[model samples]
Target: MKRYLFIMSLIALLGACAKKEGKFDRADGTAAITVASLENHLKILASDAFMGRMPFTEGEQKTIAYLQEQFKNLGLESGNGSSYLQEVPMVEITTTAAPVMEVKSAKKKFTLEGLKDYVIWTQRTDPTTEVKDTELVFAGFGIVAPEYNWNDYEGLDVKDKVVVVLVNDPGFGAEDVSLFKGNTMTYYGRWTYKFEEAARQGARGILIIHDDVPAGYGFWVVQNSWNASKLYLDTRGKDLYFSAFTGWVSQPAAKKLFEEAGIDWASTVSAARKPGFKAVPMKLSITTSLVVKAKYDKSHNVIGKITGAKQPDEYIIYSTHWDHLGIGKPDEKGDTIYNGALDNASGTAGMLELIKAFKNMENKPNRTVVFLAVTAEEQGLYGSEYYAQNPVYPREKTVANINMDGINPYGRMKDIVVVGIGQSDLEDYLDAEAKAVGRYTSPEPNPVAGYYFRSDHFNFAKVGIPALYTNTGIDHHEKGADYGKQLQDEYVSKYYHKPSDEYDTSRWNLEGAAEDLQLLFNVGKKLAFETSWPQWKKGSEFKSTREQYMPKVN
Candidate 1:
């Protein structure tokens, strides 16, 4: 009897060890995320059949169906209560401006040519929007920051007038760090905010003077939107309404207007940059009318989920915007499709690859992991904004967010660049994962460009969710930063936002992309099993909101 008992006990112990080892085995799962798998998904998604993946079109239907099918095949539960799609209702605003908009002054008058000297559009859905002989007010930077003690529109009445403002904040060219986050753009510096503030001030319209140094991109970038339509989330019932017109005028055109008003352009600009600068009237009247056509439609944000075994309420979200610029004008080679192979198709494929990695793991997550592919990102982050505003899961229960906008097609890197550095503890998690694989973390080269506010991740960050956006480090593995820069410049000049953005096997190598996806997977994996909720770092604009709202979540 004693011998039999001993043998039985030994067998039980061995069985327990085997089960534990199997559950903890992490090797095969990590290997599942591979270059070939990512490439396959990327190539298929970027194919011509996808039609550039525009929202509210046949392409959107096909793209969403493909995502849903992939999730179903992987056995992922629907993230939106038995449905993978979250409908994002949006409005399309198509504005057509007259050829010549006249500018008038007491002394003399001149006409501004549309699409050349100025470009204007209307946000209102009304059939006709007018800016008829509205007086122009030079509101400096158009900022009203109580914290910075700056108010350009203080004691000014801009009603029924056009507010002409500079593109960037006053501190953009300042040498003093004390001046409004000096040289680094504050939220007030954004063009979107300019329109928002103008509406609040009861202005009829707002025109931003375009300067390449302050705007980051060149004027040609602005010129591309001469008469293009725009997509925006529908807020018809909201009390806040947008101004009738929002526009941009070239630097030379603005200077000519200043001259016509007898205001010294150089001295006026200098005074605007200093503190205590008040609004200056251009005394110039402008008249323009925009024929507006509006339509309402719905786009979908696709979501897939892996429910947790232990704590289903806690979650980690991975985000990617799946939409890109659809078919448009033909390029020199007659290619009309703006196949955004690198912009986001590559990143979306990486998210799908992550799903495979998580599914392959023997151990189920302790906290749920969510894969979210949002839409209408090319039209301005509307999809992610909708999700963030109306989250499927409570934001408090969410642990962290990892966002992939573009994966590096250049080979492996020695470092991964972090955008919006020092925003959260997510950086620590990424640093750990990168170091384990003998890579390092570095800050982005242009932190002042406000890249953190550009991608879908910004929507998550805006709602106090601790989020991280990373770029492939410019420091290449074999070559130096110069080589990496040359490649990026090529992408910008040759393919960025152009019909020639289609994938070419000769140009791209997915080894780096695969490695990037793996790193993100590890970060998500760590958060999946962990119990601690990551906090936004102190001094972050979003930290206070996180602390205030966390306890209120059910």
Candidate 2:
């Protein structure tokens, strides 16, 4: 009887040990993801069937449907007031193509061919708007940045005149690295800011010169993007301001215009760098007209939330833009759909995988996890901006926002590139999580492009929430950092903003992407349990805003 009892006791002890080991093992905790999962998700998201996930089209419908289905499968709750769809009111303005832009000058009249030398668009809601013989004015960089102590529009009334400006800031060409982050494009250097400032100055039109390096991408990118069907959030209800016309001039076209005005283009650019430079009257006038059809449409932001077991009110948000450049003018091979496989399909899929990982966790997070797949990121971060302005949850209660824009297809690496590295304490969390996985965190390789302010996270950051956006590092397992950088450069030159950016399982290494996602998950997981609120880094533009906006705990 004693021997029989001993055998039963030993069997029970061994069974308990096996169960404990199975629970602790990473493989047991979650199923190992197959490359097939990533490929399958990308195939559908970037498929020609989805029409490139454009915001205001049937494609938007199909894309949102697929996302909703996925969220349902994951058992996540609807994030938008008992529904998964968040209504985003938008207006679609399609401008009839203009044939030619005539610039009349004192010495000669030059006609700029549309699409060949320049591309122009209008922000006005009117059916027809004309800029008839508007006077031309050189408005320096067309920037009015107080932070940099630079105001290009100072002491100048550019009203009712066409403002011609440099592509980047004054400190760009200067030898001093300390001057305006030399060579790096500041927020003032962004074309969006330039156009907005022009409108605020009451200019009739704004024209920006295009350069490859300072602008990050080549002139062809700008041409292609502007030529595509443009989408903008409906500001009809709001008192938004814009000039009569907004456009870009090719380098050659700009040179001819300046030469016709008897102004040396190179010398004027140099002179603008000096202190207290006045606007140069070009003695020229620009004439153009736009015919528009305004249609009100609605876009949806896909949101799903996993409620916290304890602190359900406090939240951590994970976001990625789901929209891309939709069907447009055919490419060389007659491919109209901009697949955007790498531009964002990869990031979208990563967010889905993150949802899976979070759901698999044994202990539910203390803070609710909100998975937000926003729309119209390509259209100047409009979806995120709308969400920030009208949040389902209070912005103060939201602990942090982690954004994924473009995920690296090339496998695992030794480091991660934090877009806004020094702006918040979020980097410290990411650094520690990365170190645990044998990786480190670094700043963006090309900071001058102002990548920090480019992605969806910037919208949350602007509203005083600590936001994080990181990309795959340059270092590669088989090829090292140089080769990884070369790959990135090749993509920028060849595939970026092109229809050729489709998915290929053979070339992609999702191992690196999975690792990055795991690290991101860890960061959120740690924060979800912490009792202390994460603060923005000192001296950051957002720090003071947080102090003013967020409720004090003391």
Candidate 3:
């Protein structure tokens, strides 16, 4: 009897050990995120049949349907209360015809070729809009930020006149540490901010001078994006305030115009960087006309949610833009479709895979996790901007947003780049998770690019939500930073925003993307269960907005 009892006790101990190992196995959940599955999804989504997944067309219908079907299969509830689609009303305007802009001065009359020397478009809805003899004023940066105590429009009455402005802020252009966060771009540096400020100043026209460094991308990106039809959110049929004509002038053209006014172009740019700099009238008048075609339609934002076990009203949002530049002017290779494989198709697929992972979790979250695939990101983040304004989940209840825009397809990395680092407590959470996997986080190498303000998360961040946007780092585990940077440079120069952005299985190693997805999944999982709210960092511009919406309580 003693021998039998001892044998039974030994078997019991072995069984207990087995149970513990199984319970703690990380693969149990991570297995749900497979590189093969992600590849398959990308193959279908990025295929030419989807017509580049542009919103408000046959392509949009197919894309949204696929998202809805997948979300339904995962048993996720519709985020829009019984509907997976959120209608985003938009206005599409195509410039049917625009002639070369003619600038007249007493010294000489100059004619600049449209689409070559300058690209211009209007925000007004009128079928025919013309600017005749509009006096051009050279505004420093077209910035008026009260917080920074900077106002470029200080001593200038730009009413009914045209304003020529620099692309980025004075601080960014000069790299001066004392100016507006130094090399890091503030909201005042964004082109959108410049346009809005121009309108507020009652300027009839606005032109931005393009330089590669300050603008982050080459002139080709601006030329291509601005040459096509533009889309904007249609807000309740209200007349939106926009300049008569908004445009970008090639660097050469801007220099020629400044020289025509007997001003040293280089010296003027230098002076613009100084405080108390006054606007310089170019003493030239521009005349331009446009014939436009306008159409109004509704695009859709695909939304799905998993309700929590406890605080269902509170929400953690995962967002990615699903739209790309549709069929447009052909590239050199004659490929017209912008497949957008890396730009956002990777992000969209990652979102779906993440949804699957969360659904397969051992236990449901304690607060709701909402998956949002927005539209019109390529057209100035319209879909997200609309959703931020009319949120399916109340802004006050919305806890945080983890946005994935571009996922690295290359191999694993030793570090990750936080696009907008030092903005919120979310960075601490990300660092903790990254450290667990023997990795670390770094600030974006090119802060002057204003990439933080460029992605879809900016809309959520604008409303005080702690939004996180990180990218794969340049420091590759095996190849090092040089190889990683080479790949990134190649993508930007050869494929970014072009039809060549299709996926190449041979080149893509999705291990890094899977790791990123896992990190994001863990972050959202923690936020879903915790009662603590992540606050924006002390000096962050968004801190006051957070305080207003979610006031700290003792």
TM-score list, all predictions: 0.89, 0.84, 0.87
Top lDDT model: 1
Off by over 4 Å in 1: 1-28, 104-110, 146-149, 155-157, 177-180, 538-541, 544-548, 551-554
N/CA/C clash count, model 1: 0
Q: Which stretches of candidate 2 lie over 4 Å from their true place?
A: 1-40, 47-51, 97-117, 217-220, 225-228, 256-264, 281-283, 309-311, 326-338, 493-500, 531-554
Q: Candidate 3, residues 208-291: lDDT per residue as tens digits?
A: 999898887888877776646789888645656778888899999999899887878888888888777888998999898888
TM-score (C-alpha) between model 2 and the true structure: 0.84
Instruction: Give the deviation of candidate 1 from the true structure as CA RMSD.
Output: 4.2
Q: Per-residue lDDT tens digits of candidate 1, residues 263-319?
A: 999999889888888888888998889998899999999998998877899889999
Weakest 10 consecutive residues, lDDT, candidate 3? Answer: 19-28
Angstrom error of the Cα, residue 127, model 1: value is 0.4
Lowest lDDT 10-mer window, candidate 2? 20-29
Q: Clashes per prediction?
A: 0, 1, 0
